[model samples]
Target chain A: MTSTAAHSPFPSGRAVPTPVTGGRGGLLASVVGVAVGSVFFLFPIYWMLVTSVKPPSEWLTSPPVFIPDRLYFQNYTDALFNWGGLKGLVDSGVVAVSATAIGMVLGTFAAYSLARFRIGGTNLSFFILSLLFMPPVAIGIPMFLFWSALGLVDTYIALIVQYLTFTIPFIAWVMKGFFEDLPVDLEESALVNGASRLRAFVDIVLPNVRPALVATALLAFIFNWNEFSIAVLLSRGRVTTLPFILPTMMESHYVLWGDIAAMAAVGALPVVIIAFLLQRYLVRGLSFGAIRSE
Target chain B: MMATRRRPSRWSGGRRFALLTVAPATIILIVLSVFPLLYSLRLSFTDQQLLSLVPPRFVGLANYAQLLQDNLFWSSLGVAAAFALSVVTVQLGVGLALALALYRLPRYQQFIATLLLIPSILSSSVASFQWRSLFDYSSGPLNYFLGLLHLPLLSWTADPRLALPSLLLVDFWQWTPFVTLLLLAGLHALPASVFEAARVDGSSSWQILRYQTLPLLRRVIAITVILRLIGAFKVFDIIYVLTAGGPGSATESLAFYNYVQGFRYFSVGYSAAMSYVSVIIVIVLARVILRYMERPVGRPAADVPVAEAAV
Candidate 1:
């Protein structure tokens, strides 16, 4: 057997292997499998897009209007402008951007320290992210009371405060991984050149991690943007955001699919766009530095 | 670079900048995450409802005691355990299959990968509504399509037994893609030669997948499973939207139960107790999985020798 055909020991960093010979049958099966998997996987979002454009008459048709003859734009407008919808958009946007900024600021500092200072063991960074398992809902009751006590309930502060539960840890974890790939020599050279440590970090290290920062910020913001339970319980409808308000719209009998779809279309737009436009960074982030490590 | 040449004096900018950088994140983390976690633990022992102005009366373990006796508690635990295991198992299994299948493909890997990720990235709330609609009895195409096959039409959400499964199916659909994406990345990272050599030795695709692919994919699979399961255990919006934990409370996971106790009924103390019980359980489970998933390479403690001494 050829060396090219023999398995390489290295798992990652391989050139895309040439397609194996005479495996069309297996490859064909794989395509069918992906088709089957992706349909159920993607159908809901596809349905959301489809419904967002469907005429009102097709909303609950028995057989379903898998295709709609006329696309409507009214739902998008009404949902965005009517019934505090615009306010919801502003609120979600504010909370997301604020949380992302705060999380990145705090998280970057911690991550850079951990990376450069060699604060703990090599794996300490990984262990820090282990806290990811602790669900935010676990603290919902205490936080609800705590925020109420401080009279911070129903405010942007509450949203930011709540968002840190996940985002802080997330930002720190991802940035630490990104920082690991940086060589220590640059910082050392900067220190040797009489540049202060802070300057070296800001000038040299921070610039290189730009892509990871953007990825982490976008991801953290999206998580905050789409958060539901905390938004519902903490803010009530007074501080309601898209996720909170969308559920309320669903509970009513005369659920306007068009309006819901319209808002969802707009709500999901930023994230879907980010998920695609920043695919390289997003994929790297979602890989969470695991696949790359090998 | 190997050693601190100057001992970086205490008043030095390096020392202070490092300290300052560490402080903000640590402070926010403790205040936001750790403090609240402990407060919830404290409230678990006392009968403290938020709205009631009266000082929190020390109930001393009564909340935990109540949880032990609450039938709903046990039921939700059963539901939670079942949900977590089934969802994780099926997701990992199917995801691995899909990933291996995709790795064999000649082209469009990025497109295929993106489709796999789209499901998880969509708003969980909307997905829940769509699933609810898909399983709707009267006019849903799912039932209509199944009806033509001479199958008995059944109430998916309305039935107590079927409700959790209905929720699970939706979750499975959304998250399997996530596991696939993660695993595919792992598979793509794996060296191609191992499988090629296995084939040279006359190994079948099944043999290569089992011994060569699966073993190499183990660490990543373990990580993905733990991450996904943790999320599964906290499932909220989908269930809340789909069944509201109904059909006679059949679908209430610990999350749903905590929400009702804390938010709807305003039994703040009771909710706090449940919260602690859950946080402790989840944290313990997380630690256990983290330990098992990452045992030998957990070199943070091992790296402590040089770093702490330098400090």
Candidate 2:
């Protein structure tokens, strides 16, 4: 019956009661459960890291080397310089950053409206939710034809614009939830002082929700960085994103396993770092802000 | 309901401001969704060929007619449905159990939770690559471990019988943590007084879990299921990486088949029609789920008003 849990921004925040006193057996079961889960989860990432640093001789060998004796940078060199990893990294970064920037601006603006004015009510919100369910193929197919027609194929604009389809809705929805939970008094006071609504939103309301904004933006960035289907469909040779090109490396006849691992390691690095940084917001971000963690 | 409440100009300038702010994103979404759909619908009825010298000709429902008879279409639909169903069910069950176990832990809960998130954060391509090495036919660590135990070696992705299951295993490895994370948050957020009252009243642990925990966690469970099912239905990246829907179309999901039809063959009309059919299926399924999500789940004291206004 202690009240020492962390403070939460949620309106429903409460001091979590102590965990059920399940005694020694329960603690033992809990530790065992986590150990089992951790192996299933972390071992693959370990394999990826080990594979990236493995020499060519070790990569395809039977009884794959659990640990490489010495680190090899050749795979990393070939992946970055010879293959498209460097280009993929730059392209993916540009696209993800651009999309995240635009998405945050447009999505935040729309979310504020939806939260405060309840614009179009649940109908608008539902429409946005439905977009998330629409298959990427459905979007990708037509986008391919349209972009090809406009001669915009393999362009950053094509990928960024197409990314907006998902990003806008996702960011808008998550931020809307955050905005809805905020007290209206600060913004109202600003408005009553003859400040414009836009000014009030920018100065008073936005600063209050800064943490949520940062969390939502970072998650949107990760989503865009990891996007594949749209990238593959919209770009081929010119604007090759990391996810799009990794498969080509795999499908090539030679199949440089070490190089592929190196590229994947490089590609997955940013998102993993961000995930650690956003550990507190991990559930909220992944769940599109439907579940907030204390 | 208080007459003393100073109603801000919610009806006058506020509505206009809302419309102005929301219009750009809303219009963009509508245009992007509707135009492609209508254009794709138009293309669906025509024999449009991207690589052909022959011009497109209107084919009416010929594409749809052919789709109904196409064995690949039927099989791919079956694969996608089964894959989605299996992954969602397994992830949910295992995730819920893991959440319950972690919930009882008195320490190190946050550290473990953070570590479990590593897989979900990685892109699908990287995850697939990791699994590919693990599932390598002759030299994989999996077979090596199996060999140490004197067990028979199994070809993971190459064998037709094991291909889908292998994909499922990779998916389970990558995403079970996500489901677990959501459910754990839900568990942590639950008001503990109810459980206290139940225990004080002499309720057994099993009875408390069945009557109290499950019902309270229903909304979070539903959200987790819906999100996972949606991702599962559109599963393409992992399939493309792991199997390329290979071993003679044994692993081709609907999205993969659509890719092959459109990109590989340049059969634009047929692909467009297939896309529409899949969209229809998703829309229908989403409509049902969204309706469920919108319904009032029990809200706490401060949540009720905000929930009503937001919904």
Candidate 3:
């Protein structure tokens, strides 16, 4: 087979092979490997979806039902309304959205400064990056104590504040990388043409980085949405997120497997959709632009 | 007229603007992160308990002393280390193999890779819940399938021997895609010219991979390993949901232990000490990895950017 693909980094590195034709056996092995890997990767998700729609009887049946006898849409409603999953979902949405919005706004400014002005030098950027490596639990513990002292536990503000520590650094780093790659001449030219720095940034540079901004926001949202440890510790009753609620639901009497499955499915659906839709930007965002596909 | 006059001093004006723009984030990080870090450092030295009536008392080194002596503390550290080591190894191995396989088939690579990326994007708690149900002893499809094959059923979460490994399996299933994508990116970034040279010299695929591809991919592999290692060290959500360090604390990681002590037991001071110890280990590991990453392999050190090197 030919091995000349373009060098675009989108959808991952371009597929350039070694021009060696795989024999029939090699071809068969490749197909089998891909198939098995795909199944292993997808089965749990498939099971979650199927189990969410299954009746309780089929849920526990031997030779577990691959497809439900009847599609039970009630499981979702029961999960959302009766099981308090609605509150969890709303809480997660609020925290994630607020955290992402705050992180992006603050991060964009810091990133721009670092990118354009070299504010605080390179050491400052590295310092921010190092914070990303610190385990959230380490930070979460003292924050828990501090928030309790301030009577801020179980409040959205408490969670959002802590989430900023993580999201801000992330947004700053990713946005810095994006800003570095953009040509400064446009902004500089605008500045020379009587526009203020702020005006030049908003009018010229911001439009250029809009895609990166969206990608970073989505990624930050995902991180907050998936966050469990800090949320679990900081929020007890009033601001319980979906992830925090799942374990509690499991701990309660008469474990409702169907409802729990429905909750998990519903909770994961938006992220899955966002991931699929924004797969390209997702790659760049996750890597902090270290592996951008040009 | 005043605004236009001030424009000539734009250099200094820009500097002030930049600092103003950066201050909110820097200040927020300091208050939220740096302050908590300092507070936790202080709390680690005190005799503090959330459930206690008395205020915290200064008890320097007492918490650390007790932590060092506690068998559960030591055991949890071991468990965290083992979990991190095993998960990183397994994920890297499986992920690299899959990446290699996927790299060959250019036709179906994107479609399959996107499907593989699904598990990685899902929240750990949600993934844990899904896996928890899948591993359910009585009703899980895993056991059902085992029964169909006339194999003995396994209690995945309840069995002490299996609980940690079960958590590992869930993590492995979820994160291997991340490693795969990183390595696949590395593989794609390989210089095709080198591969062409090897092929022209009549090198077999295996020979090319071992002598050529593997050596070139070392930096990426190191990166993937370090990232996964750091993540695995902080694993809490999956274990928290799957077993809560259950079946006799068999699955308790260091982070989970900290969670239980601080939140469940209200032993604030002790948990703070544990957090400090964990943070030290992570920072030390990151430093060591960064040092190793800086060592020049075929290329000059200057060729790798500082940001990428640090990453």
Candidate 4:
């Protein structure tokens, strides 16, 4: 159902094409409907922004401050410095980046084998995709026991290793889809000309799917960065990711609404930017390649 | 034997390359995913406690037997089911409406869709916090708006009855856009010629949608539904932040209860049993969906020309 007429015969990384024409009266209603729906969807984000900048006095006003007349940078500074947001974000960054680097390299190769050679065929593909569906707690329990036994809990290595359970499979499955979409003519011809298998793949195949590689990596990074369940089980206080820190803030003597919002905004900003940048592949990535971008 | 031998010899180097490249990821998955699953499965049958000094002893079927009769288990399953069903249903309904609406405005579809990605793109923890302020009893914008309309102020996540619904609201806000995006893509893929033919035959817009558009959209809808179902079942982040399964366990999902058993109470054996159950349920659900999704998209009815059929 993802077909687009104008798609080039040779697969190049691009988004699904726009739809054909619409009926006459439906256009006006669509405008109004989408506009209203946008407000409903966007209001909470606006509220978060408003709360983040509201002064302490305006934080809990009965008539909620829709617009915080006076902007405050104190909340941002306090959350970043006094609270654990900065440290937590840094921890999250290290874990996500390192894990993604390893996962992409490993996954790209596995994906190549799966797509090109059809290794283990459907069963192997199913096994990998199923990992995405497995609830984290199932693995989290056993992982906790294993890591604790190794005395590796709360270390960056422990978190990075655990993250591979998700990232590797995710990248492998998504990238496999992209690889399959690519024609093998170029690689075969390169190999026939006496280029080594690895060379043919690295020199020809990799460049064609560059856009997909980046999109898959970013999506995998987001999953790692947003992880909460495994982090909650594995980390005590030593290795706090941004998501893990928010709950602790809520548990404090008094809930710091402004500070929490500030921290959340800080954590969410990067992914929001990436989400737009990779908008073409967003649906494909989120759906784990089930819905192709034509 | 001869065919297999010939196949390998034909691409001997390629075969070796495939094995070498695939080995690392396959090994990692085995260690991290397969090994842990097997360990957890073993743990489920044994009386193990992380905090205990006593060596673990196997107690086959005890934990599973207890789970069958456990009231808390039953209640939490009920909660999980209710939350999953309602959220999936509502999201699909609202999502279809919005997608159809957006389909009519091709000029602004991409722009609007991009903007709609914001909520889903945010981490669940951050999204939950955003909602936390919105559902606050005293200072929440929702209640404030209620007050302006002369309605009594209502506690959202604090009240026992309202708590789950409140969490549902947040899930709805965050995920409906995703459903819309998928369905809109499906809508776009429908052939324009089919719609034009139906229109020429004097069929109304609703008739064309009912007869032509929907049948072609079944595959996309199925994929979307299963994906959402799997996601709804695994919902933990928002529930953790928003309600913490509070107000006398009104919002305590099976996942949360499992977490409490495994992590907080350290009933390793019992928690592992629950985890196995959850995994089995998800595996079964996903298996069917995956097979359906993986099936080749053959010639859909829309591809058949309309003029020839009328003759």
Candidate 5:
């Protein structure tokens, strides 16, 4: 019912036709506006890079340098290996991989079933997507005790399972939408040709939706990779994820921005790159099914 | 397929497999996701502490009563509301503006879009700690930058008044793109004909935006607002890392308050009750958003004018 509104913003980026009397002024204003906007948008990332490269001397200097004199590569090198680097990396990697694996292998089938099968109602998709709307703190404490009772606290399994509360519902809901947008005739033809349903799904339908599946897995991986609170709640120092570890570095008086920046930059690199590369699907993967209003 | 199968008394392979395969994940969700939730519901009524094995004595209305009378509870609610409203509104405004600006910039749109998506991908804690140096009072970049403009030095975390807004600024910086992305999608999905028709008929940009784009985007805006609001309401990780609801609860969102009450103070029942209250607010907010999106905006009534129809 809502689609009939008539005016559009003319796609707000339209180059305003300059007036002759104020011609240069209008052009100059827009140019300045663009530069200001670019700075505002980019400054934080720029700061992140700057801090990572700054020598310990310039890390917290007065009038922080927009550019550093010497490239401080050691900051990154130190942050990683300082806190039992390989071990921290392994722990974080284990938790993230485990969570993403669980999300993918199990979430894929449920998502496929939800998309293809008419389960309970036409609006089941909305119901599923709405699960992503839940705040994690909603269940964090309860799950903490639950996992503790299972003697799973501070273990990899506890954190991995907790990640499911987020990744499963999100992956399922998003992949279901991606799957629905796929033409069903390819799978139907396979069914008609006497291949079993599972085979057809694996060989035919899956290959087609592989981009989205990869995207979902990667997104799920990133979510787990970056998650801190649950890892903190369940795993104090025992199973520290990268995010959990980074914050503890600030507790000391000589807060090393050189190392923190290096770690932050390095840590953010993989997911940030993935997010950029697969955003064609990952952005869609985020609330594509979620925005269905029913 | 069910109809086509002979001996239909037996379940078809697809149906059987789907059921069998789906059940494990469903069961896990029930056990891990739903059961703990239900468990928490039960615990909210009890006098149970973490270590206690003795069955929780049913405390009935006491937990709820305590939460009602709790000063911290009220303050927390206020904090949460302020954070949610301020942060979400700023982000929404900034995001909408950015999206509009970038929408017509065909050449730079892709680069800007990628940059915009960074916060969504970066863990908030990572963003928080990285930003900690930026907000440092004495020698930080923020003050240094302000020093350049000869502006008064601002204490971001140290000053009680500024702490909340400081955190909000962080949230706005990080999440505006999310709002932009959602609104951008809505912008993309809009039909071109309506805007073109208005343009052809000599409508000005301001009138067209007011009369046209706003109405068409109402549902998307509502959904984005709701999602972002709920998210802001639950703002925890970043704030926890940077401020920890610092300078005397200035940045204490409801979720953080609940965390403190339960974990720090060991007031489990009171915290549980607080959680229940917050959950109700979130559910209502979400439902309102959901309901708002579904309501008829442009479905023409007999009396409404074309220009004002979306309103």
Candidate 6:
């Protein structure tokens, strides 16, 4: 139902003709529109970069310095080393990687079962999909309390487990879609040749779904990395993530724009790059397999 | 080939393996999500305080009763509703327009769409900080730009009147691209044949869009709106960073208010009640959206053209 065959303008081995009606005026208008929109979308990112390099004096200038007069490389180091920024980044990284790895492993096994065996049938898939609709805040407070009672607050395990509530379901659903699209004959033939089901799955199905696995892991990592409310509620100063730290940084007695900008830029850089590099899969992942653009 | 000997054991073994594979995820989800839900529901009925030395006691409907009477709770709900409504409306409008424009410009479609998605992908906290600096009264780039344009520079975050709108602006900047991408995906999924037929019949572009494209896109649009609405309802990080729901709680959303109640004020039971109310609201919205999804698109059968209906 969500296949991109008809929607994708650039289908494999086929070229779609540009519609013939629009004239030069239309082309010019499209060009101008795209240019203006790109600037609007890109300006803040550009500003973050420029502001990160600007001297402290230029941060609050009357006519805001569009470009820094001198490069202040200290901002990056200061933001990273001082201000507890490195700790935040490290915490975020550890939680995200752990959650992604765990979710991927669990999801892959479950998805393979669901796809190949039709275990629990179609209603089960729908049930998993329903979990995606839940607003995180509804369960966030309770989970916070639960973690606190267990003496697990401010621990990586608490965040990773919370992250799994969303990621595992997502990975299961998306990977199920991917598994269904793969040819079943290869695995079946292997089974006929006396390979154990697990062995065949390990040797045959696993390699075929490598790309999907990577995409799912990347998307899950980004979600965990960018998550805030759970991180805020669950972690006190001990395991503060970048998103939680950014707000505290803003609330400091003296606002340092350069440091904030540098930290923000650095914090956002990895995910932004990953999103761009894996744009196609990211789009597919974002849609929850409802729009399989890939 | 020894087919019969291997078949029975293999079949049962496969079933057991499937069960084993799915068990861990199911157990984890239940422990994390379901247990907490039940726990919170129980907590909401008791007057539990994190900092207080008093033992918790079941108060039946007292917390819910208090929640209904609390002006702050009501205001936060109203703020959340208003915020969600406004943000979803603006994002839908602007996102649809941008999607349409990008659809028209086939050459730069991919590049521009990717560029526009940057904000949506960035951490909300990061985006909030970027906008917070932009909305800064004295030295912020926004006011400076307004000054250059010879327009009055308003205090964006500090003024109660402009605070919500300022936050909305930031939200619009961050999430409109998300809507745009979804709509674009929907547009791509549209059957090209219908548009071609409409053009062949000399239907105007506006007419084709209004009749054919929009009708076919009903489900996609509904899904996008529902997702955005839910997201807007849960908004916390941006509000926390940008205004901290400040100017005397003028911009406090339900989630942010609950966070404040539970963490800052240490009113555990009251916050659990608030979270349940938020969940109930989301459930209602989801039900309505699901109903819309189940309904047939466009007008009823009697109003349809016979030729089109035949298909």
Per-residue accuracy of model 1 over A163-194 as CA lDDT, tens digit each: 88678877877787677667666777888898
* lDDT winner, 2 or 6: 2
Candidate 3: C-alpha lDDT:
0.79
Q: Native-contact recovery for every candidate? A: 0.42, 0.50, 0.47, 0.52, 0.28, 0.42
Q: How much is the lDDT of residue A166 in candidate 6?
A: 86
Model 6: docking quality category: acceptable
Tens digits of lDDT, candidate 4, A75-111: 9998989888889989999999999999999999999
TM-score, cand. 6: 0.89
lDDT of each: 0.72, 0.82, 0.79, 0.82, 0.70, 0.77
Tens-place lDDT per residue, model 3, B1-311, is 23224334444458888998999999999888788888889989998998799999999999999997998888898899999999888998888878777776676566677779989888898999899889988878888888889999999999999988888999999999988877776666666677777877888777888887777777777777888888898898888788888888788889988888888898888889998998788777656554443221112222223223323
For model 2, the docking class works out as acceptable
Q: Output per-candidate TM-scores for chain A, rounded to 2 decimals.
A: 0.87, 0.93, 0.91, 0.92, 0.84, 0.90
CA lDDT, candidate 2, residue B280: 84
TM-scores of all models? 0.89, 0.92, 0.91, 0.92, 0.87, 0.89
iRMSD of prediction 6: 7.2
Q: Please give the ranking of all candidate structures by TM-score, highest first, separated by commas.
A: 2, 4, 3, 1, 6, 5
* Candidate 1: segments with Cα more than 4 A from true spot: A1-22, A120-131, B1-15, B52-55, B288-311
B49-85 in candidate 1: lDDT tens per residue? Answer: 7678889888998988999999998898888899999
Write model 2 residue lDDT over B1-311, tens digit each, in one string. 12112445532467778899999999999988889999989999999987999989999999999999999999999999989999999999999888877776535666678788888888887888888889987878999999999999998998999999999998898899999988887777666677778877887666777887777777778778888988899899889888989888999999999999998998999999999888887877677666544422111223212122222
Chain B TM for prediction 5: 0.84
Q: Residue A209 CA error for candidate 2 (Å)?
A: 0.6
* Predicted candidate 2 versus true structure: per-residue lDDT over A1-294, tens digit per residue: 021233333212212332333446755776788889888899888888888989989988987898999999899999999897899999999999999999999999999887777677678877888887787887667888788889999999999999999999899978887787776778778888989888999999999989989999999999999998888788768998888878788667766888989999999999988888888888878887666675
Give stretches of model 5 more than 4 Å off.
Answer: A1-34, A122-127, A291-294, B1-14, B51-56, B285-311
lDDT string for model 3 (A1-294, tens) is 012332333322223335222345655666687789999999998999998998877767766788877899888998999878888889999999999999999999998887666677645765676677777888777787789889989999999988888899889977877787776677778988999988998999999989888888998898889888788778777888988888878766776888988999888988888887776676556655545533
